[model samples]
Target: MHQNNLSDLHRFIDRPTSTWSGRNDGAGAAHRRVHQAVTSLGQGAPDSADAVFIGFASDEGVRRNGGRQGAADGPAALRSALGQLALAQGRNSLRHTDLALLDAGDVVVSSDLEEGQKKLAAAVRASVDAGVLPVVLGGGHEVAFGTYTGVADSRTRKTAGSATSQQPGRLGILNLDAHFDVRRAEQPTSGTPFYQALTRERAADTSCRYTVLGISEANNTQELFDTAHELGADYVVDEDCGVLNQQALLSTVREFVASVDIIYLTLDLDVLPASIAPGVSAPAGYGVPLEIINVVLKEVAASGKLAAFDVAELNPSFDSDGRTAQTAARLIHTVLTYYTPLSSAAPSLR
Candidate 1:
């Protein structure tokens, strides 16, 4: 049965249970893995789940942006990598929780990128309403727009006992990318989602903030930098985001987290060194180190304000020995291990 009336999420194709199968070392929690903890979204409503995984299967935006394709296969490859990982030990282990691991499956995007984004938005909204964190797997950085809309719309819904408090709270978008994707375009593309988001927020006068870390000065044009500056967005160049300055970066992340009521974290894999993450449309020539990225993820997860998250630009066609997908999975695992809900109070469910 459908989770709700959010039909825009056309034909939820449940990924096979075999996709989640992996090493089983015994009956002990110490021997458990991700595949053991996760369950299909169809098993039950995600109302009681801690996190719900949703896949956006499309690379139409990349094509429009004049980049190599194949990121459309990112979701499945990511799942395969994640399924094989060992769970963290001690108190941080997912095996300790009673909550289910829900995979709601892919929102297929054919020729129409906009329509596909709408379907993704619907799926995300449904997951948010059920009080579950939406862990989105992307087809491209274009996934950012769809993910943002869902989280933004969810904040507007009239929840129980908050009819008078329908005012949407501040949203902070923290982008980990090599490029400041705020390009001017006649149509939406991988390089224009942030631009689109900024425009929408400005027109509504919402208190949303967009910040990009790990921006490669060599990759983005002067126009993009000027646009980001003119729009009042904060960003740090890749040179300034080295592992040696991790504390400073973490401080920056913490400050951003404090400023907003919630956070939406989007990672374009191209932000990492091409050697570390080579399976993206535009692999980084001198990207931020993975160690720095790991620390940032820890800070964000511990903040308890992270409402939604997505990893973008994982093009399997260019991946080397599946390294990119594995790295993405590792990052996801780190987030899952450290995430803390906003408060002890029960989340306001729709």
Candidate 2:
């Protein structure tokens, strides 16, 4: 069934307004301005552009947590924060000459697990068909299934009519999180996306190779590690790496990116130390510092082959004075800057 009403899905902000300077001043000005801009621009017409950033905040699983009900508001909050940073960083000044962006709104999911996945898949497929790179923001890690499904669908279409056409190259997943998130989808929660992606036929056919970084020993079940090995994932445990600084992490990520055709980045905020991102679902005691995360993101963006990005598990309700949101906003800004490419002087990571 066609979910969104196409007529209602027109551009959010058709013409730029003079009053609407897409700037993120310190005040909530930028946030409100972007909210209005996107709200006015609305959803894009189907298959509409060269590149797009789709934000999905899955709140279905969050209902299980008592104080985590506000995860649904994550996409908006992250966008607001991103808007402020974009304004501060003058992101509008760096829009790619050839690439246009559309903020495809969140997917409408039903209570039933299968139904929700189906809805999410359809939304992702629509974005792909339109030739948009969907940058998904999530309510939980389970959102990966929907995001990956979108990319996989595109690959499937390109190979569908050809008898001898080889499958598309592997999707390099740079998953920066505290836990492996390889739990089986017995019930389809935040811990299950990677497992489902590896185990399912559609996703497996895409030959998705995962690079799981910032993993805490405490969170890794033997089964998760065993499954990761069985599935051929480059599992990097934080302890085994032994005192890795920011530059070292960037190098490692660069090596991983070189090994794949397209990159899909998924960041679970819990990967950061609780002191930095206390708003996440499961804050690790000792996690990657915020600076290291930024460097990794910069390198990933500079790679120039980033297919999509997802920032997930941010619980604004738990954020203290929006510190976590601010941090995430900065990272998003860095990503945009890395992808923006100012001049010929800019180093190419392609």
Instruction: Find the 10 residues in a row with the least total lDDT in model 2.
Output: 11-20
In order of appearance, the predictions have TM-scores of 0.89, 0.77
lDDT of 1 by residue, 80-193 (tens): 998888875665333223335677788767778888787787777776665667899988888999988887778433231123554567778999999988999998899998
Off by over 4 Å in 1: 1-19, 45-47, 90-99, 156-166, 344-350
In the range 1-350, model 2's lDDT, one tens digit per residue, is 01223233223212221122345434553333332333212434333343345555566664532225556667767876765433233444432322234565665444654465655666556654443445666767767777766666665344433356476655677888888877664477677777777777444465667888888888788898887788777866665433455456667787886776666788888888889898876777888777777777777766755656778888888886887887887776667556622111335543
TM-score, prediction 2:
0.77
Clashing pairs in 2: 11-41, 12-40, 12-41, 12-42, 13-40, 13-41, 23-87, 24-87, 47-130, 58-139
Q: Which stretches of candidate 2 lie over 4 Å from their true place?
A: 1-51, 62-69, 87-100, 155-165, 201-206, 239-244, 340-346
The total of clashing pairs for model 2 equals: 10
Error of 1 at 77 (Å): 0.5
Model 1 CA lDDT for position 311: 90
Find the candidate with the highest TM-score and give its number.
1
